[model samples]
Target: MPSADPSTQPLKSAEELAQSRRRFPGESPQYRAARNALLKEEIELRRHIERVAAQRRALPPGGEIPEDYRFESESGPATLSQMFGEHDTLVTYNWMFGPKRQRSCPMCTSFLSALDGEMADILQRVAFAVIARSPVERLTAFKRERGWRHLRLYSSGGNTFNRDYADEDPDSGDNAGFNVFVRSNGIVRHFWGDEMGPETADPGQDPRGAPDAMPLWTVLDMTPGGRGTDWYPKLEYGAQSKTGT
Candidate 1:
């Protein structure tokens, strides 16, 4: 593998790169047909996903948005609903990217560093933020060190937000995750998290119901492996777990 230049980027995902290579230089009937078939399949899958999401949105209203989930920020306090900005929804990524003592989560960092460059469009549609129990100052410092400028971050350090979100459980020794918050009937209810049940490397890993960290995967798909076996994220402080080597 070659060293990537921090300043220069092609912004292509592993899959995209693979696709580009798979294309034929000369017009071969078989190649063209294969490509078209793949394209059609992908389009169908995407449409199916969209339709499912539409159904989820169309589900009958459930509960009311809680007005009292107060969070203290650098500027001041904000309600859970206010975290979405002026939009109707918000996505928060529970990042382990904290101080040097803690370093960063390799998996989370890989996903996050990918987020540094293009977020304007996503923000325009839905509010997004990376929330960590660590201080905002720590979060900002780490982001600067990593050169990730496009992501929006907030401090949940001073509050019970982490506990409430299920990202951290003092009893379980849990770490992190991604969650989605939706406001309905003036109450904020958490609609999604990693509870879908997928076996993974980390003792605890939840598929984020949010969309903030996806752009990087989209870009990385342009690469050859397209996020394969060789790729794995780690914690910067040390590769081993806190409780074990």
Candidate 2:
């Protein structure tokens, strides 16, 4: 292969890159060859993710929010605009924990559990909040139960925010949704949302976004089992004593 800078030479197609002959220890020649081929595809997948993200960022202004939706936060009532403190961008994740449901969706809970750890880092760039249709007290209790300290939790119990934002399914009650909004010159406008659901899911695959928001699934994907279809996160795992049995 040429040693010149990659930019100086013609771009290598994914197919050409798959021809890498690198080898690893304790691996059969067949496995090494297959692994090298897979690496090229992974590289292309990364580039595609960046390309789609750029397209999303370049989207024209989305529909302006119809009203200043109200919500109940830890510090009393607040409006949509108030949620965006010092940033022009806001990301709201709608949790599927409705008043009528016994518990929140396991999938949503799993995703939020991971997000809670990253809330501080995520907030440095943009405002982030978690909204649920349950009463503030109920939501707060769950937050405490989960030991989520960084996620800013809010209640949409008395507002139409959930209904208007596709977070509440009229026929099925609560649903999980991720919405992004932008505030410019005192105007709040919808930016983007994860609209992919059962309708958009591919054959034999779950309905999920291109770049999954949950790290659990991503990590599991690299394993030999490849995210087994029968397994999913649970609210609580079997108890284990501190000391080894």
Candidate 3:
């Protein structure tokens, strides 16, 4: 059954809405009012986060991308220069699927799904592609299973591409990341990535990726927890929402 949206529901009568001495699990005269104040704080916090994300996008894309950086693509391999075409900047998402991992990564899967659907608008300007450290064939198969249709996918497992660029550690088994690259004066440079936590984002101050780009905060904000704990977004099917995935 479809869930009923509270926004569309009819309001309760004043008498019906009135609570007894114990409205919640415990009896408290101030609990309801206290919760109401917290709701306002949350709304303000969200607005602040939005403000920070805007700052990050507006800060300017920096760093010089080299010309010789090899990025594998669906049509085989191509250098960073070739990927940019007439456009000077290129953004590559480091997808987390490798030969050793049996299943496609959940977070990367979700991120790619969102990018695939939204590529048409960005394609008119920025060059965006998903790059994996895994072999092209392996990455292709993984994408097929996920039914990813729009965005281009590639593999750069052959060389030090992932290591020199995206920070993939073959020995550590920690995989998948996203990095934005820009080319200027025939040099390709790395600008932004999603791996670093507090230092990179300053979640309390600078919400770099912000609400839409990341899955954790987007999903968390809907719940009562509101990104309260330190839980990481897991690799699970259906976690990639339709708005994004």
Q: Which candidate is the best by lDDT?
A: 2
User: How many residue pairs collide in each prediction?
Assistant: 23, 0, 9
Tell me the tens digit of each residue's lDDT in model 2 across 1-245: 85888535666788777776666678898897788779888989987998799899999999999999989998899889999999999999999888888877778888988998998899999999899888889988988988988888889888888888865664578878899999999999999998998899999998888898889989998999998887677787667323221
Give the per-residue Cα lDDT of candidate 3 at 76. 73
Candidate 3, superposed: residue stretches over 4 Å from native: 1-43, 54-62, 198-212, 215-217, 225-245
After best superposition, candidate 2 residue 52: deviation in angstroms? Answer: 0.5
What residue pairs are clashing in model 2?
none
Task: Tell me the TM-score of model 3.
Answer: 0.64
lDDT of 1: 0.63
Per-candidate Cα RMSD to the true structure, in Å, reads 11.0, 4.7, 10.9
Model 1 Cα lDDT, one tens digit per residue, 79-130: 6677877887787777764433356667677777765555777788878877
For candidate 3, write residues 22-114 as lDDT tens digits. 356774658776665565566666657866766766756565544376767888778767878777667777776776777666666767777
CA lDDT, candidate 2, residue 94: 90
Question: How many clashes show up in model 2?
Answer: 0
Stronger candidate by lDDT (2 vs 3): 2
- Quick one: best TM-score, which candidate? 2
